[model samples]
Target: MISKNFYYQLITRVLGIVVTAIVMAFFFLKEYNALGIVVAIALIIQTSLLIQFTNNTNRKIAHFFNSIKNEDFTLRFPENLDIKSLRELNSSLNMLNSMIQKVYLKNEAQEKYYQEIIKQANIGILTLNKKGHILFVNPMMENLLNYKPLNHINQLAQVSEELHRFFSNIEPFENKLFQFSNEREKVQLSIKSTSVMLNKEELLLVVAQDIHKELDKNETDSWIRLIKVLTHEIMNTITPITSISASISKFFKVGDSIKPINELTENQIKSTSKGLDVIKEQGENLMDFVQSYRTFLSVPNPDKEPISALKLLDNVRLLLESSNTNITIKTIVKPFDLEIFADEKLINQVLINLIKNAFQALENRDTGGVITLLAGINENHTKYIQVIDNGSGISEEVMSEIFIPFFTTKNKGSGIGLSLSKHIMRLHGGSIIVVSNDIETKFTLLF
Candidate 1:
């Protein structure tokens, strides 16, 4: 109907123009005809009215587009336009405006959610541009940094160089440690970063978490465990010794004072000697327990150096093979020249520990099992060494306790192997991760 309206409008204008021209021609050429004059006047008036109608419709269309550009969704058109085509165009514009309003509301709601999450997040977070300009510093960041509302990443330079360095050159998917003092309070923060583009501007969305309290809590827990173990061992030794010594004292009789040791029977003497011997044995065991605790507590500082990963694995393989000739060792290094910066001797010890663990996991197999040593760089360019074993994997219950010093599942195990490995990785600014399944147990050292 709208298309037909447009067609009729065009034809009407053309016919009116032709009629007016013919009437003017007759009036001028044939002296004067009243009817021709009247008809020409009428035609002119009709064309003027048509031009005004076209202008009104054009004005309404222009206004509708202007409203859209200005984001004025409230601007509404009346549905009673006389021209069918103009009315249909108005209806379509109104519909489009309604959809835009709905979309705008939805976006507003989503933005609100984002703001709430950012504000309440526990981790210190901020968005920074390539130029190091900071934006959207969350409350956690303010508290963590102890900075008066930061305006730029460089503002952290006022706090400490370590803090400044962290926000300045952060990379995508990077996890880094930053230590610095804010006033008198020293802070150890773990900084992580991700890349994002918001409002067509590239940003580094960084998070900083002050792990000082967490470390303190862990230290407290370790101390508690050590105390518990010490208490248990001491009580086990001292209780028996105390009972035996008391029994020996009963042999002496006080006649005015005390009985002479020379008057004791052979059975009493034998009993006393046996008790002392037992005490001596228990004392020796207690000493061994204390010594193990000392070894566990006094992990040597790492002597870090750049060492080829393959060579490290090979050294570990040679060491393990020399002791246990039955287990097969397979070393695989991707881009075999991959180098890890760590304490060569310490890293070797860690590798030996993990490989030995893998071998032990496979020990009971009827067929000699293979221990796999793998080295590669992850997508984030982190160097990793994995030791894999196809054995009965670790149980969930045992896995959780494996890294605790003196916690173990095997007989004759002192249980510090995994714990010590973890300590070495931390010293070298890396981590150790373990994954166990029915198929295999994998221990990965990430650097």
Candidate 2:
């Protein structure tokens, strides 16, 4: 509410100016004398000065609001106004401007703080609109991709189509595992997507961390475990034979007394024969274990070549045709021309091993038993050859150890098949994963 004095002052000034101007005009027209004209000029001058003086506070207030709008908050409010209401308005505006300035400074500081964190993070970060236009990209993103000035998600298509597909189909909270191949090497990236809304614009925020080193660490750990397992098994197989040989030697020496070379009893001969047989069996088992280890480590560097997926699938089908297993085998090649760059022989070996495993699973089934080799690109446009079996699937208990070397469930299983396959894929800068349930099982080789 305006103060009574403030309202009356405005009314009084306007009425005074109008009345004096009207009287000056009347005197000028009624008497054209020198005194009358002089009086009229004096009144006019007084009115102009009064108008300017009365509006002096309003002009200053307008300039104050203009300064606040422009964020130029250095304008000082008048402190010496004779009018009490004008002084109060000026004081309130000054205080309000000061508070707004503090709030603006605080907000600016917060934005800078977050920006610094995002810039220094090790993971690549991206904020994009619904059209895939990059709204903001952190420095880590440029480092990870080695693509400077990234403006749109479609730019990834020039680097890798798989990467393009990945971002386009990414959903909130989705975790995606993919590899980006550069000229020098391939980097394994694990990305997670989150949805955020800023200023009413929907955006997808993605965080990608390079996991190549992590994978190497995990692989090194697996190798260590395998070595330990090998050591344990070797000691276990040899320990029994060592004890038996020592006991047999005691029998030959007649209970610690040196006997003649030919003075052995009939029971001693039998015992010796039994012990020899056990020793030979254990020796052969150890030999077999060593041979398996040799085979496991004998994987030659893949002779890299552009191998047609269809041709590889046909070769596998022919190889499996020689087996008498009644389980049906089918081949599916999406786009028919789908191909991969890998060692043809190694990939064939992996595929054949997977098909053999499927056949074993289908052994007792009479109907609805089939193994399908599906070759296609995943949604991320990465090449994949998946072996799916509709027979009794792998149990969860057994699934976990399927890829561990020398761990097997089948009677004649050597247990290194899956492990070898995994190593081969890793050599090709890819991986293999097994997904199984009660109804179906899948082994996917991703490249």
| Candidate 1 lDDT, 73-125, residue by residue in tens | 89988778776777876787688789998998899899999999988998889
Residues 140-165 of candidate 2 have per-residue lDDT tens digits of 88777767788998988877788788
Error of 2 at 344 (Å): 1.6
Give the Cα error of residue 237 in candidate 2, in Å: 1.8
Stretches off by above 4 angstroms in model 1 are 1-62, 65-71, 127-135, 145-197, 200-206, 229-274, 296-308, 318-328, 339-343, 363-370, 395-400
Model 2 spans with C-alpha error above 4 angstroms: 1-224
- The lDDT per prediction is 0.83, 0.83
Candidate 2 achieves a global lDDT of 0.83
